[model samples]
Target: MELFQNVVKLRGFLGRNADVPPSDGITEDAYTILHLATMSGTWDIATNDWKPRIDWHRIICPGPWFCGFTRGMRRGEYLEIEGELRDFEQDRTVVVVGKRYPAKHLSYTVHATRIQQLERPLLVVDTGDDG
Candidate 1:
């Protein structure tokens, strides 16, 4: 299956669970910002065409809402992710495109923990190539 399809499936699964921890609760304003970011994917600096990059971290994670969540986390509360943008798919929901680091990295563990805590299906797409 495609990355976006997997994300949608995950979201559906998360929606069914009641014990999942909320990820700082998404606000209407945050949602609006996300919408805008998604729309701005048409401007390509290199190609100069309206081709959207499928990298969610670049398109969505930099928004005020995501930044707020990252900032709100206490020290050592969550793992820090650092990687390059890969791809994204906008089918019903947005799916992030990136790759996780080595198992020794705290970011990987933190991401796994966060995914478990999510009340809604939050898809973190990995390219299976960690380098």
Candidate 2:
């Protein structure tokens, strides 16, 4: 539990520095993808003492749209994606399917998942309404 907590703190710090410049030879697009995969959501956990394990519904990329890239790729293109999550701190690793330029081919199915610690309060439980 303590190790997970430390990992969460580290993730938070890294997320805060998400806008920092990237290393040499790394394109802006690559950096953006990395950032999106790692730090795309708010961190909120149900309890501070324990980090919850989360199983996210597979995120399906519609058509040519990359996860965070506004410019769509096309309708049979496949991309390699890997992800990890601890509590609510989640990160995804994506790889372009082929060496094709402009990646026009679409994928039949593409999904990505990640784990991260959330920093928001959960919604209140719903109560039955009395008419």
- The TM-score, computed over Cα atoms with residue i paired to residue i, of candidate 1 is 0.19
lDDT of 2 by residue, 1-131 (tens): 35542111112211111222224434434322222222243346655343444222222322222333422322112223434322332344445785433323432221224323334344485575766
Residue 89 displacement (Å), model 1 = 23
The Cα error of candidate 2 at residue 104, in Å, is 39
| C-alpha TM-scores of all predictions | 0.19, 0.17
Ten residues in sequence with the least summed lDDT for candidate 2: 7-16
Tens-place lDDT per residue, model 1, 1-131, is 55542121111111111121244654543421111111135677798666754322221333334544443333112122322323433334333576443332121101111121123235597777989
Q: Estimate the lDDT of model 1.
A: 0.30
Error at 67, model 2, angstroms: 5.2
Reference-based lDDT, residue 105, model 1: 17
